[model samples]
Target: MAVRVLSIDAAGIDLAGVALSRLEASLRKQAGDPDACVADFFDLAAGSGAGGVPSALLFTRGHDGRPLLSIAKALRQLA
Candidate 1:
């Protein structure tokens, strides 16, 4: 498995109290893991935001020798 990395920007979404909820939903829908947990899979890192918007860096390594980067890239493409 290879490591995967992704950066998300939540600047103008104005989701109010649903930011984390929305992110979890997106991760579940896109990653095909209904039980997706940020702490379980991703390593949170500092991310640069565009226009000073909030941003986050998510990184993870694939399990069982799979490439996490490819998985993340594929999911993004599908999304």
Candidate 2:
């Protein structure tokens, strides 16, 4: 299985916890695997309480440990 890293901003809401949870569930559902971990990073400029922007990095492992798509780049497409 490949590792998928999804980075999301924590400033939009209290997404650090829930975002990763949702991502993990979604990935597991889609790939039928339960191998996923989340790494949260804080960006000093964008954070409210802190000096950085809180970001979440979700790592998901698929059957080949590779991502079928890059969710982060895909999000840019929405823009």
For residue 45, give model 1's deviation from the true position in Å. 6.3
The number of the candidate with the highest lDDT is 1
* Predicted candidate 1 versus true structure: per-residue lDDT over 36-61, tens digit per residue: 64434454433344412222212344
lDDT (0 to 1) per candidate: 0.42, 0.38
Q: What is the TM-score of each candidate against the true structure?
A: 0.33, 0.35
Candidate 2, residue 61: the lDDT equals 31
Error of 1 at 47 (Å): 13
Candidate 1 regions with alpha-carbon error over 4 angstroms: 1-16, 45-79
lDDT (10s digit) by residue, model 2, range 1-79 = 5443334454544444455456656766766655433221211112334212233112223597543333343234323
For candidate 1, what's the RMSD?
A: 10.7
